[model samples]
Structures are given as structure tokens and as C-alpha cells.
Target: MQRAKFAVTLFATVMAIGLTGCGEEKKPEAPKPEAAASTPPPAATVEIKIGTVGPLTGSIAHLGKDNENGVVLAIEQANAAKITIDGKPAHFTLISEDDQADPKVGTTVAQKLVDDKVAGVVGHLNSGVTIPASAIYHQAGIPMITGSATNPQLTEQGFDNIFRVVGRDDQQGPAIASYLAATEKPKVVAVIDDSTAYGEGLADQVAKTLKSEGVKVLAREKGTDKTTDWKAVLTKIKGEKPNAVFFGGMDATGGPLMKQARELGIKAVFAFGDGACTDKMHELAGEAAEGLLCSQAGIPPQAASKAFLEAYKAKFNTDPILYAPFTYDAANLLIQAMKEANSADPKKYLPFLQKIDYSGATGKIEFDAKGDRKDAEITIFVMKNGKVEPIAVVKSGKTIPFDEFMKSMGGA
Candidate 1:
């Protein structure tokens, strides 16, 4: 009886242990929290470098700085907008180099920009500098658009990468010459040049146009770009006593030339090309600048888009001196082409740039087969009341008064 009772007890204990094990196995796991939905990581940001080259420290440094400021404003606006390319956020950087308006220095700085791996370039304000520096950019397959360089030779080189937002010297020359012939009706006109590529090339065009118009053109006069003392040259020109004189040089030299001409009693109607068309001329020549005539390769800064002018003034605390509007357009051209291509690579975006019809601060901008701005306008300005005021605009072979042109531009 005792052995049987012990067996029952052992059996009952084993059964209890088995039941406990089954209960543990059947127990439900604590409810798991729901998983959060998966999300993809944000796209990486990209850095794009755009270069601007110009005379940042010399006689025309003001103009160069203006060009640089244009690019800076464009880049800043693009960043503020949080632009994207190929699904990646794009950040633009401006790489500015000072060419000092010197061709040799221009080439050197151009190579430096190439080595810096800039996607594109915006200048080298002087044609003399732009032409040589262009070869460097072409060799590296980089695109360069000049905001102010207007020498025909720049576009005549047949480099697909070369472009300018301003009218060529050839175009500007004829426009100003025609206006001079019509307004002044001078019997004899004297042509003078600063002997740089831009100055000499423009003077040649002027002389050619004047000859075509049956105006008596005296022999071309020459001086270095640095020639501030014009007493000797003016003495020679004064002896000729031409009824009208055209000076193809920057305001720096042209201002002094005009001031000295007035002092020397040379009472000729002084006309200048885009180089000397600036408010600075008045400052440089003082009261002598009044009544002087000048031509600009593009519309005056006052004619730029209200947005651009306001932005420029807000940033720079002054109006654009010259070429800033074009440089601003040039920089936007690059950025727009990059966006269209979805890539910042020059090789990828260049074709878009070649065919782009960009409506920018200046106006509608389009490049022809030769990479020159199509239907570029040449503006005539007169120094009145201590300011350079646009008097007329020459566009598509038609000269329109400044007021009418402004109306046509929707009063921009």
C-alpha cells in the first residue's frame, strides 16, 4: 500500500510540471508596438562653382567689381531659392579673379580658374583680355560669356563656348557714327583710339562707317590706354580742327581728353564709345562732361528690370556703373542652362546655353550661331545735369527715342 501511494505522488508531481510547461508555451507574447513607416533619406547637396574674371584693381576696377557683383547677386538669389538639380540641392559659389584688364594677366587668371574647376566663367571685361583668356577656357572645354567685351573678334573666333551679352564693337561703331552724322552733320570728323584691342577696333569701325556716310574722316590718332595727358595729341587734333571728334577709350582716358580739349579751346562735338559712357565721366571731366555724347553697347542701367535695379541697389548701395546688368544676365544664363541640363557639367549644359532664349534683367537674350547676342541694342547717351541719360536706342537697324523704347519695354 505504501509503495503504490509513493508512485501516485511521483506521477502527480510529474503531471503538474508538464502542465506548467504547456501553460508557459501557450501564453501570448506581450503586444508589440506598431512599427513607424519607412522614409527615404534626403538627397545630397551639390556644390557648383562659377567663376568671374575682370579688372578688379586697376583703372576699370569699378566696372570689374560691378560685373562681379552681378554674379554674386545671381548666386545669392539662387541659393536663397534652394535650387535643385537632378534631385540634388545645388549650392553655387562664386570664384572671382582679377585680370587687371591685362591680357597676360587674364590668361594667367583664366588658367587658375580652370585649375580651380569652375564650371563656367562670366568675364574679363576688356576685349584685349577676354580674347586671350578665351583660348584658355576653350582648351579646357569651359564656357565663358563676357558681359562687356564687345570686340567683333571675340565672336569671330568660331569658338562655340564664347559669348557676349553686349553688342559687338562693329555694331556699336555704326550706330554711334550714324547718330553723329545725322545730329552733328560735321564736315570733318577725327577718330582717336587708346590703341588697345577694344579701343582701336572700335575706332576702325567708326572710321569705316564715317567714310561710308561720305563724311571726311581725318587720319586715325593713337594713344595708350593710360594716356591721361592729351595736351600733345589734342594740340595735333586741334590744329586739324575737325568739326566732330570720336574718342574710343574708357572714361578714365576719355574724360581727361575731353577736359583738356575744352581747356585747349578745341570746340568740337566730343563723341565717345561705350568705354567712356558712364557717370564717372562727369566726375572725371567735371563740368566739361556736360553736352558730351556717348554710346553704350546695351541698354542703360536705369532700363534694367525694376527687380534687378532694386536688388542691386539694396546690395551695393548704389546703382550699377556699367555692364552689371549684362553680367547678371550672363550668370543667370549659366544657372538656367545647368538647370535645364539637370547637370552643372559644362559639356552637358553648353548646348542648352547655346540655344537658350533667356528673358533676363536686360531684356530677351538669345545667341546666334556665332555665340553673339542677337539683335543687340546700342544706346545713345548724353551727359545732362551731371548724369548720363539715354537719349536714343538703336535696335534692329532702327533708332528709337529713349522714351519710346522704354514704352516698348513695358516701362521697365
Candidate 2:
């Protein structure tokens, strides 16, 4: 009986083990794989081309390069900021062209930019170049903003697409002439200009203002933009013994004229317009640069915003010569208008640009109905310590001391 009981218990234990093994026979259904990561595709990007034209290969190439650098810096900053238009990431591309500061070349460059489908343009530094190039851009419905061109005829042509960041030559001419009349108190002043549109136009305004001030004006003297030797003209003017002499030309020629005037013992106070108002004057004119008076259509380079100055130096490893701040502002104005309008098309953004009131590296920037900068300031400078230092700022017919103007602007 005991043997029979042990056999029955052993059979029951085998059945229990067989049932447990059958219940685990699915083999855990093979470990399931993880779903692939659901990464959204990269955000859609749009390429926007912006054109910049200047005298990239001539005497004023430095100034043109400065303008180009300004636009480049602005584009770089805008890209880094991830600027978007119409829900698409904007990748700005700079298309730089060399105008050689020639109007013919300027028009060609402008056409090239238009064909390239650039959203906007910031260049043609010379008024002569800007005037003709503007027509091309207008025909293409492309907006063009000049940072240095000051000829009033540019905006007077009634093209809504034309704009400038600097004051007009009409405004600048009177400011410098008024300052010269008040300070020099000259009984007679001689006016000279390079035969270019900008130089002749500015010189005409100066002559008019001097005549209005009851100062006897000598007949206009002429020189080409490339005239480096002015000994003949200087000798002729010296014979007249004018109390003051004003040159409406670029520093490239103006500097040599000033040095030659001094060497010829002209003994007259030398004054120049924005073209000659540069630190390079010291290098160009040597010791003769000192005590020379000049006027800039906008504030001095030193008067630009601190943030802009620092960034400019860091990016270019050099200080801004002139008009870079304006160009920088011009480029930003284009981008800002596109963002405001939510479109990169020139027709769509042009309206926004017309109505924009932007605070830029230079200062508050707004446009008049004529597309000229409103409330633009003309700064009178004197060469001191090999630098063009501001002495006064003329804005809206009111003259303010440089220090006072800077304080009003919250410092440079």
C-alpha cells in the first residue's frame, strides 16, 4: 500500500511540472522594438538677396568698402537673430557690386542687381552715381537707399522708390556756409568745386548762401574729381586775396588742394564739405590739415552709438571712417520693413519702409515725403590732433554745441 501511494504522488508531481512548462511555452513573444524618433523636418528657409553698390576699386574704395562692411554686418546680425518673413526663415545674401563711383557703371550695376532679383539695395555712394542708378532701380520697382549721396535731385525726381539716409546737399551746403560766415566773418569768400554733380551742386548752394550773407563771392572755380594739382587755381585765387576759401570736393582731391594752398601761402581760411571731412585729411594734408574747417552731412563718426562702434571695430578690426553707420541703418531699415510687412517683396515692403520710424546706430531715422532723411543734422568739424572733431551741430536751422548735442542724444 505504501509503494502504491508513492507512485501516485510522483505521477502528480510530473503532471504539475508539464502543465507549468506548457503555460510558459510562448517564449515571451520576442521583445518589441522602439518606435523611431519623430523628428520634425528642418524649418523651411527662404533666400533673400540684398544688393550693395559702391566705388569698390577707386580712390574712395575705402569709403565704399566701409559702406559694404556696414551692410554685411547688418545682414550677419539679422541672420543670427533668426529673422523670419511670412513664417519662413530668411537667409540673407549680399550681392556686392563695384560702381567705380561712375554713374555709367552705377547704372550697369543697378541693372545687374535688379536682374539678380535683390529685395533691396543700399549703395551708390556718390550722388552722381546715385542719381542715374536710382532710375534703374525705380524702373525695376526695387527700393534703393543711399547712405552717402546727398544731392537733392535724387529725391526730387518724384520716384517713390528712392531714399537716402543722409541730409541733402541743400541742407548741408547752407549749414557749412552759415558756419563759415559766422565764424570767419570773411568780407570775401572764394568757392571752388569739382565739376561733378555733387561738387558743383553743393558749391552753388554755398555761393548762394554766402551771397545772401552779404559776403562778396568770387566767380566759381572749377576742377575735375581727379585734379590733384591746384597750384594754378590757388595762385589765381591768392591774387584775389580772399578772406576765406571753400572747396566742394572729396577728400581725395580736397586734401591735396588744402596742402597746396598752404604751401602757396594763400593765408585764407580753408573750409570743405562732407567729402573732405575725414581723419584721412590729416594724412593727406600733413600739418596743413590742422585748423581746417569742414562740414559733414551727418554727425561725426565718433558720435555714433557705443554699441555700433564696438561691434564695428570687432567685426572689421578697424574704426568706421564715414557713412558706415548710415549704411548700417539703411540695411537694417530694409530688413525691418520686410519683417513689418511680413513679406520680402519690394512692392510689399516699400510701403512699410516709407512709414518706418527706426532708431538706428546713428540716431532716430525717419523719412520725409520726399524720401530724404527728416530732421537730419549737419555737423561742423575742425581738424584737431589729426582727427576731425565736431564743434557744432546744425539741425533744423538751430545750431547747438557739440557737447550739448551729444548730451541731448544721450551720449555717443
Candidate 3:
């Protein structure tokens, strides 16, 4: 009986082992490498191009670079933030083009940007270029913002796609004229323009305003944009002995004019518009820059945000130039529009961008129906000890002292 029980127990144990093996066989197996490969990867990121066109290879290339750098800095910040447009991860691709400050070249560049399908454009620093370029961009339905081009007709042309970050020449022209009448008290102010659309238009406005203020305009001389020889102009102006001389042109031309004016014994206070109010003037004019007064389109650098200054310095290894602040605002304005409209297409976001009231480093940035910046403040800088220093600010044609301007910015 003991032997029989042992055999039965051994048989049952074997059966139990066979049943457990069958149960293990029914379980699911792991997937193979080939099967795993069938799963799709995450969606690829999308790209949107932002065209930057300016005079990247001309006499005022420094100003162009400053404008370009501002846009680049804004793009870098957007990329760092991992910007998403239209529900997809979007990257901003810069399509930079140089027009050599030529209006015809500007039109070609604008068409190229249109053909390249750039979503937006920031550039053509000179008014001569911006005015003609506007039609090209408008035809293609591309929105463009000018940071430096201040010609009023640029906005007055009725182009819905055009915008300007800086104040118009009319605003700046009248403000400077008022300051000159009230403070400079010039008996006769000579006016010289480079004969380009920008230089001529601005000089005309300044002359009109000065004449309106009962200040006599001594000479409305003409100078080509590339003229380095101011011998005749200076000789004529010196003979007149005007109390002040206003230059409506860029730093490249303005610098030589300043140097030559001093060299020719023209001992009058030199005044300049936004086009000539660049930091490059310091180096270009050398010691002749002393006591020179110039007008810029926005608030003084002293009131710029510390964060902006620090970031700009860290990125470019230099301080902001005349129009960089406005350029920064222009770039950010478009990006903010893209964010709000939830689209990267210029046609979709342009209306949003137009209506945007962005408070940038410049000031409260609101656009008029004509695409001009509203409530624009013109900052007047004086060359003191080899640097341009803000002495006063004018808003809506009212001159405010430097101290008072700072206080107003504080909301006091």
C-alpha cells in the first residue's frame, strides 16, 4: 500500500508540471524591433520666414546693422521661448537682404521677399527706399514696418500693409522747429538736404516749420547723398553767417558736413534730424561733434529699460543706436501679433499687428490709421564730451525739459 501511494503522488506532481507549462505557453510574447518601428515619431516643427531688408553694405551700414541686430535679438528671444503658431511648433527664419539704400534695389529685394514667401518684413532703413518698397510689399500683401524711415508720405500713401515704429518727419520737424524758435533763438537757420526723397522731404518740412515759427531760413542748399565735398556749400553758408544750420540727411553725409563746416570756420550751432542723430556721428565728426544738437524719434536712452539695455549689450556688445529701440519694438510688435492672431501668415496677423498697442522700450506704441506711431515723443540729444546726451524731449509739439521728461515717464 505504501508503494502504491508513492506512485500516485509522483504521477500527480508530473501532471501539475505539465499543466503549468501549458499555462505559460498561452501568455503573450514581447513585440519585435520591426513592430516597434511602425510607430510614428513626434510631429516635425514648422518654419516661418521673417525678411529683414536694409542697406547692409553702404556708408550707413552701421545703422543698418543696428536695425538688423534688433530684429535678430527679438527672433532669438522668440525661439528661446519655444514659440508656437497655429498649433504647431514654429521657428522664425531670418531672410536678410541688402538693398544698398537704393530705391530700385529696394523694390527688387521686396519682390524677392514676396517670392520667398516671407511672412513679414522689417526694413529699408532710408525713406527713399521705404517709400517705393511699400508698393511692392503692398502688392504682395506683405506687412512691413520701418524703424528708421520717417518720411510722412510713406504712411500717407494709403498702403494698408505699411507701418512705422518711429515718429514721422512732420512730427519731428515741427517739434525741432518749436525748440529752435523758443530756445536756440536762431536769427537765420540754413537748411541743407542730400536731395534724396528722405533728405529733401525732411528739409522741406523743417523749413516750413521754421518759417511758420517766424525764424528765417537762410539757405535751402542742395547736396547729393554721396557728396563729400562741401566746400561750396560751407563757403556760401559761412558768408551768410546763420545762427544755426540744419542737415536733413544720414550720418555718413552729415558727419563730413559737420567736419567741413568746422574746418571752414562756420561757427554756428549745428542741428540735425533723426537721420543724422546716430552714435556714429561721434566718431565720424570727431571733436567737431561738440555742442552739436540732434533730434531722435523716441524717448532718451536714459529712460530705456535696464533689461533691454543689458540684453542688447550682451547680444551686440554695444549700446543701442538711434533706431535700434524702435526696431526692437517693431520686431516684437509683429511677434505679438502672431501670438494673438494664432497664425504666422501675414495676411492673417497683419490686422492684429496694426491694432496692437505695444508698450515697448520707446514708449506706448500705438498706431494711427495712417500707420504712424501715435503720441510720439522726439528726444533732442546734445553732443557733450564726445557722447550724445539727451537734453530735452518734446511730445505733441511741446518741449519738455530733460528732468521733467524723466518725471513724466515715472507717471508723476
What is candidate 3's lDDT per residue for 66-160, written digit by digit as tens? 88888888877876777777777767767789999999899999999999888889887999999999999999998899888977889999999
Q: Which candidate do you rate higher for TM-score, 1 or 3? A: 1
What candidate 2 gets wrong by more than 4 Å, as runs, is 1-43, 102-104, 184-204, 210-268, 275-290, 385-388, 406-412
- Steric overlap count per candidate: 0, 0, 0
lDDT of 3: 0.83
C-alpha TM-scores of all predictions: 0.73, 0.73, 0.69
**Candidate 1 residues 1-412, lDDT tens each?**
9999999999999999999988676432211110011112333767688999999998889999999999999988887777889888787877889999999999999999999899999998998899999999999999999998987899898899999999987798889998899888999999999999788888998899889989999988899999988999889989988999999989999999999999999999999997899899999989988999989888877778878988999998999987899999999999999999999999999999999989999889999999999999999999998898899998876788998887666554
Residue pairs that clash (backbone atoms under 3 angstroms), model 2: none
Model 2 CA lDDT for position 50: 91
Whole-model lDDT per candidate: 0.89, 0.89, 0.83
Candidate 1, superposed: residue stretches over 4 Å from native: 1-41, 58-60, 100-105, 184-204, 210-268, 275-290, 385-388, 407-412
The TM-score between candidate 3 and the true structure equals 0.69
Candidate 1 differs from the real structure by a C-alpha RMSD in angstroms, to one decimal, of 18.7
Instruction: List CA RMSD, all candidates.
Output: 18.7, 19.5, 17.6
From the highest TM-score down, the ranking of the candidates is 2, 1, 3
Model 1 error, position 297 (Å): 2.3
